[model samples]
Target chain A: MHRFANPARFLRIAKPLTPALFWLGLLLTLIACIWGLFFTPTERLMGDTVKILFVHVPSAWLGMGGWTGIAIASIVQLVWRHPLAGVAARAIAVPGATFAAICLITGSIWGRPTWGTWWVWDGRLTSMLVLFFLYLGYIALSNASSEKGDTSRVAAVFGVIGAVNIPIINRSVVWWESQHQKASITLGGSSIDTAYLVPLFIAVVGFSLLFGALVLMRMRTALAEMRIEARMRRMAQG
Target chain B: MPHAPFIIASFAVTGVFMTWLIVSSYLSMRRAEASADALREQS
Candidate 1:
């Protein structure tokens, strides 16, 4: 695992994997979209509006997942000082921020019809909004720092501190009397019926793959930029 | 459901946002790769 810590080796491995991931993500997203839009039955209560869950839920999952990735990478970069961890942290931020934003927007869209408002000051919603801002802060801090090492350290601290909100975000439904719904998939209970579950699961997998592909692609871009910067700096110094 | 307009609005808004995200990311990555190629050419 650590052997691939070298960016060069990681790129060599990821280059071929990129095409495969791209196709897989594309195919799955297409299938999920078709299944979700047409195949899934409309909820008798929410009716066609319920279809928003297909996109909204998966994006919410990925939003949390991306932050988890950043937190782990940040920890690794700070504690272990893994060669590529900082780059991984930075690469993950772009997609994480995008996913977080999507989750918020989609949730707001879903809320307007169901909750009677497009925006809410609910605990869960507010925490998720904070998560999105945290991602932006990490990106901005990383970009603003002059030294690579300093940037990584600053961003790492933010990543770890921001992570305290994830559990708070997750548990906001239970902690506060809120309009947001509880877990659809619980340890011993699933709120969703079997009919809705299938397509929902498909969408979740599809969205996960899409997130993975985007993160990997962005990482590759960041790696390329770093290489170019390093070469230019070396030339100037020489 | 009872609200067709709201449903359409939701889908349209979400779809447009997702489309923009995918396109912008692709363009950004493309530009970065182009710059990398240009810098490599210089070196």
Candidate 2:
């Protein structure tokens, strides 16, 4: 990780890696979604509504996964004072929020068909909604702090604190009796059938790759902006 | 495809959101890098 501490070295790898991840992710998404939507057999219980699983599951994973990233980045920023940590955390905010929203919207779409309703006050759903709102708050607060030029610590603290929601989100279904199904994929084995599981795994990987690429690109932009600011300050002194 | 609209809407929304997010991030990177270059030359 420290090897990438140098901006130029980071950019050298990121520039080439960005397009590779994007295109590969696009290909994988197309393949997995196509397979999941058209090739897989209709689920016995859920019928066609199960088709939403591909997108919904991946979106949900990334939604929570993104926050996990922010929390780690926040810790790095606070403890190691890694210069790019805040930038990476800030870069993660928008994509994280977007995925969280996608998860909710897609989940709601799936729920309407299966559960005969558009919304629920259930534990899994509500905790996810909380995460979405947390991302929104983090984005706003992070932006406000960065704009003022010296409040990254506040945002870092928020990232660290907000992580308390993640475990709740994960355990919500188990702790509370909700319409939401318990975990299908667990340490023992997946309850999901092989036909559905294969494509679902692919979709998760595809979405994750795309998420990684977006973060890299955003981090690049932040570094560039930092450069512009530094250069402008130097010119002003002259 | 019993509930075609629901499934379609799910895919559609995902497509739109991911496309917008990826495109905007790429464009911002391009713009920021360009600005950095221009500023570097000025200095």
Highest TM-score scorer:
2
lDDT of 2 by residue, A174-194 (tens): 999999999999889999999
Off by over 4 Å in 2: A147-150
Tell me the TM-score for chain B of model 2.
0.87
Residue A167 CA displacement from its true place in model 2, Å:
0.9
The local distance difference test score of model 1 is 0.80
Best prediction by lDDT: 2
Measured by DockQ, the strongest candidate is: 2
TM-scores of the candidates are 0.91, 0.97
Chain B TM-score for all candidates, comma-separated: 0.85, 0.87
DockQ of 1: 0.49
Instruction: Kindly provide the TM-score of model 2 when superposed on the true structure, using C-alpha atoms.
Output: 0.97
State in Å the error of residue A224, model 1.
0.8
DockQ for all candidate structures vs. native: 0.49, 0.79
